[model samples]
Target: MKKVVFKVGGSILQELPESFYKLLIELKEKKVCDPVIVHGGGPEINQALEQMQIESTFIDGLRVTTEEVLEVAQMVMCGAINKRIVSLFQNQNGKAIGLSGVDGKLLQAKPIKDGKLGFVGEVTKVETAWIDMILQAGGIPVISPIAAGEGETHLNINGDTAAGAVAEALGCRLVLISNIPGVMETIDQKEIIHHHLTKEEVEALIDSGVIYGGMIPKVRSALASLQGGVEESVILNGLEPGDILKYLDGEKVGTILSEKEVVEHV
Candidate 1:
């Protein structure tokens, strides 16, 4: 069976309803594409850091991880948020295992940006044997974005990048599950979502200033996954949980991006 990596952000986690988990369970139980999750914990981390009187600094959208910040992030991502996701699945009678990149050296890495962002790393390797084991055993693996770094050090990884890496390693489709409906464009004075886009189309949109700011990184990351050998990348709305199934059914519910200009729904 094919696999799909669902990348979810921390900000939208609480907004996801139980029906979403139930859909995931149905996907697993029905022998559809194997659904794996890589999640973020930004809001929870911010709350934890604030309670501890710690400040967060960001450079180019990445958190500058000091030693203390790393501890709190690790605690929140691996411990609290991870288990909460697992429990959500279990609550719906689904088998789900929560893991961090540190576990079993799942994601081995080294620091990026010349170490300017302390303890922030990129994935150099992904050991997918255990992930396959979990999938074969009929369980969903929910991963947190924390990489094991050199010589007993742990590094923070951006969740989208982490998901892209996993999709690359597994040679699978990557679904970016976010709050927004999809890439929107004003056509005929009506805001309409572009259900399909190629790299050239995306670039044209970018040039026309249709895709700007915050969304640039998102679309770029999706394109990067295609370059890294992922089959396809989709921008999906987590709020409309049913859209996932719609996309899978080739109903054009969200934006499907491809390297080539050809439009293939499924």
Candidate 2:
């Protein structure tokens, strides 16, 4: 079965509509795609940290994960958020198994930023055979971004980075779903999302300051996914009804980020 890795942002999870999940079931039933979900829980983590009176910080879109913060992150991501997604799938009549990178050594990693980022990790390796096993059994894998090291060490990975790595490992499509619609730019003095973006075009936008902040990592991950042999990469809003199917059908629904603009198949 063809695979697609979906990276769902924390900000959108709480409001995910049932119809969004119905599309996943449709894809599975129709044999259109096998979907894997990698999720983030930044908002919930922040709230939990605040409630516990623990300080939090981020540098360049990566959470500066101190040991204390990592504890909070693991709880919110692996415990709360992961099961929420799994329950949603079950309620939608889809069989989903929630997992962490630590499970079955699916993802292996080492500390990044010379340990300055504490437990933040760069994905060194991804094992997709087990993921394929789940897919073969007609089960969707709902993954949290928390990873484990050699022993007694858990690493927090960026959701987009994790998703991109999974897509690269599977050599499949990558769909980056967020609350916002897509990558935006000012055209004719009116803000509009670029339907298709090339490397050069995206670079120019970054240089011109049209793309900055959180979007930098997102677009960069898309470029990285394409370079890593992912079939296609797109950034689109998950809340939009039927947008996922429309994008997969190549109907120009969202911002298509690519090394080059390839013709859509359907």
lDDT of each: 0.91, 0.86
Q: Candidate 2: where are CA atoms >4 Å away? A: 57-62, 189-191
Candidate 2 residue-wise lDDT, 69-93, digit = tens: 9989889999999999999999989
Lowest-sum lDDT 10-residue window in model 2: 257-266
Lowest lDDT sum, 10 consecutive residues, model 1, at 257-266
Segments in model 1 whose C-alpha atoms lie over 4 Å from true places: 263-266
Q: Model 2, residue 23: displacement in angstroms?
A: 0.7
lDDT of 2: 0.86
Candidate 1, 1-266: lDDT as tens digits? 88889998898899998988899899888877899999998889999999999988889977799999999999999999999999999999999999999999999889999999999999999999989999999999999999999989999998888999999999888999877888999988999999889889999999999998867878888988898888899998888889998888778677888898645645
Model 1 RMSD vs true structure: 1.6
TM for candidate 2 is 0.92
Instruction: State which candidate has the highest TM-score.
Output: 1
